[model samples]
Target: MSVKPQSASAPFAGPFALGTLAAADGPAFPALVDSEEQVLDLRTALDDPALTMRDLLERWPAVLPRLRALVADPGAVRRPLADFRVLAPVEPRQVFQSGANYRQHVIDLHVAHRAPDDERPEEERRAEAAEIMDRRAAEDLPYVFIGLPSAITGPYDDVTLPAWAKKPDWELELAVVIGRPAYQVSAEEALEYVAGYTIANDLTDRATVFRRDMPQIGTDWLRSKNAPGFTPLGPWIVPTESVTDTGDLRLTLKLNGEVMQDESTKDMIFDVARMVSYASQSTQLLPGDLVLTGSPAGNGMHWGRLLRDGDVMDASITGLGAQRTRCLAEES
Candidate 1:
């Protein structure tokens, strides 16, 4: 099947991004999205109507050059992005999330959740937290936890705020998409396994984060972070080559048009390479898996303003696209 050439200009000049989009009359399919909000149906472009994002990643070495060629010289019919509903870029079989990996975010959490009976000055507490962070950076490994892929949602999807969640919050993160299989890989070689980068808003219910009922059991990530639609995954995935500097990318999240979290990836205690390498030590990383780098400082808890019904979150990572998610009250 040959793709018909188009007279309209190409959507982008260089490296392209990938996404999942569905027209009103069809099922969701993998697509190539351009910077100008245009889309080329990947299934149609590649002449394989059954192609998925996972299929491309699994065979990335061969597919990469073809994708680059397709981007440069169009052979497919292009359509306006508004003609379809965007979905989560990829449906990973396993999702690994790094927690407390941002130095300042950890300190912010410490300050925000100070012991009620403690009488220390705020500045003194902050200093202590900072010192602890420094020590942890030098001595600790990345704190990784498993996240259910069932929680994944589209970039523009409306997330239902669970009735029982009193302190729902946003955590915008830079998500690394794995292309090559990796097992116990070194940090230096970890990036070679990366397929691309995308955005994820790791919504959490602060009230459920710590199991107060059983303090000894500690944090309950499954209950606090894995609600359906809690993770707004992507607008698109920008290939690794497109991102020049992963270490310095800026992450910005705006709540109701006001900037809530704005920080750089440089603040991460464990960078992307380290996070991916650490996770690979325990389990083999496969194509289409996601490695979520921890969120930076400035969550709702720190601002004393948790999520409520009708709140809109606009999250973006440098080089990767942005995602706008709205919050709705769960129906009784």
Candidate 2:
């Protein structure tokens, strides 16, 4: 006996999804989707004239049931994805990025900055870093930073390396999109506030990360990480209901055709719920707010190969579609 091949329309391809998409000549619009190959045009499905990702998220409680029904109905206005362009799923009102969240990434950073004359065995150095990370996770709060909305660009857009930037780097992260208001939420209840997840390339200017002018003030993230087009975000938003495990996802990034970062979210020092709950303690996270879970190891600083003009980066997380960005030197 022979088995039959599965078709694109089959249920085995995984559950359906929703995304923000547009035609080649139009502005972004909300969508109900099946896969990259099949998109069900949703502008008419939604009666609102100004529908957007933020709009969907704000009305998530009411829209979710309709979305599920649309997922089952196969006769909606359909179009091949090749005819449409994907956009950043949401225009966030606030962006919060978790810093130093991966255990192995932290260890690599510590080992990279050893003193020239410091002579410690590799095993000893590794052990020390691990111990510090363990203590930090147990006792310390997650380090969260604000990101400007102006820094966000479409997933396939060109990223210009500012003329003043010398050591630009790539940090691909898994970012959670908030669907409901969250203030003073407990860690155990935090996941309920999430709308979905998407991919973000949190581009950084490594050389300017620290503030030499005011050592006391320490890091200057705005100058280093929020330059125009620094955050290349989204090909699609994978709804929270579709994702069963936030702690286990394979994330990978490539420069041109060569792989640079390949790691799992299980390596995170602080998991997604902890980061969201910790962030909400101080800030009111509204619908469309973005909580960026930090990147894994294999950044430019760790690899000794920083980003430059003419390089292309392809970053992806499981289920959340991939993003491709081309780098260019800023024009004078």
Candidate 3:
């Protein structure tokens, strides 16, 4: 599950920094952007023990220049990549999750739970969804739910399956890392608040999504999604400048090396800018807030599969590095 270090002879040009892993004493340091390297022995790039990636985001304008300079300098400290353990890029203060934003994913769910109707054809139902999707895009409102930061875990950490969860599933999403304050901003100006992007697997407990006892309350995402290790995030963050297009990146998840979810951000009913702008209406997105762009189709439920103990999920977004998560069952 490891890769070779970047060749010393040919190093890529500067302007990117987002990898972080635990050091011998404490807080993870930024990994080098020097070519395609997996060696962590490069030494601590940022020596601030009290600082986390959240701090970096707050001071992005300053840290970014330091990152670029570090990458270009040849004699910077480095250690063996295998020595350090990976950590989530940032421990965000607030997390906003967009729901029902993927067109095809919603259609798939509708088809699965469709009622028996003699008059209307299946095609008619799909057409209706498409129309609704168009209206949603046109409308300024976007649906978002609040999530606890405690649910966050390292990109490669194992997800602990609670005993209460009957059917656990994976929802791989593109997570937008907020770098600046945003309040009631327009969609046209939302991207300016982003620091970078990372991969997120929003694990949900399907069976517990709704409380049958209180059907009137609707979906319960907290129980269904905020388990100890529900949100697996980041090998590192890819700076916004490095990402040329957020609307067209491909997101894919492989379970045990078998591709399950494969779709592009192009299918999103509300793109990243819209989601951020929508969230900022009521919430003041601070320096390390996160907006999880809803996941696309091909979830395990749609594929007649659900996660179990010993299962592995390898998720990746174009440009952003990959994440590996192993699913484990909880014991009494």
Q: How do the residues 152-227 of candidate 1 rate in per-residue lDDT, one tens digit apiece?
A: 9988888999999989999999999999999999999999999988899999999999989899999999999999
Tens-digit lDDT string for candidate 3 (50-86): 6566777898777777777776766776555556667
lDDT of 2 by residue, 178-278 (tens): 99999999999999999888889999998899988887889999999999899998867788988788899888999977999999999999999999999
Whose lDDT is greatest here? 1
- Report lDDT (CA) for all predictions: 0.87, 0.84, 0.80
Between prediction 2 and prediction 3, which has the larger lDDT?
2
**For every candidate, C-alpha RMSD to the true structure in Å:** 4.8, 5.3, 3.6
How far does residue 28 in candidate 2 sit from its true spot (Å)? 1.6
Q: Cα deviation in Å at residue 327, candidate 1?
A: 0.6
Clash pairs, model 1 backbone = none
lDDT measured at residue 277 in model 3 versus the true structure, 0 to 100 = 94
Task: Name the lDDT value of residue 76 in candidate 1.
Answer: 60
Which candidate, 1 or 2, would have the higher TM-score against the true structure?
2
Supply the TM-score for candidate 3.
0.90
When sorted by TM-score, best at the front, the candidate numbers are 2, 1, 3
TM for candidate 2 is 0.93
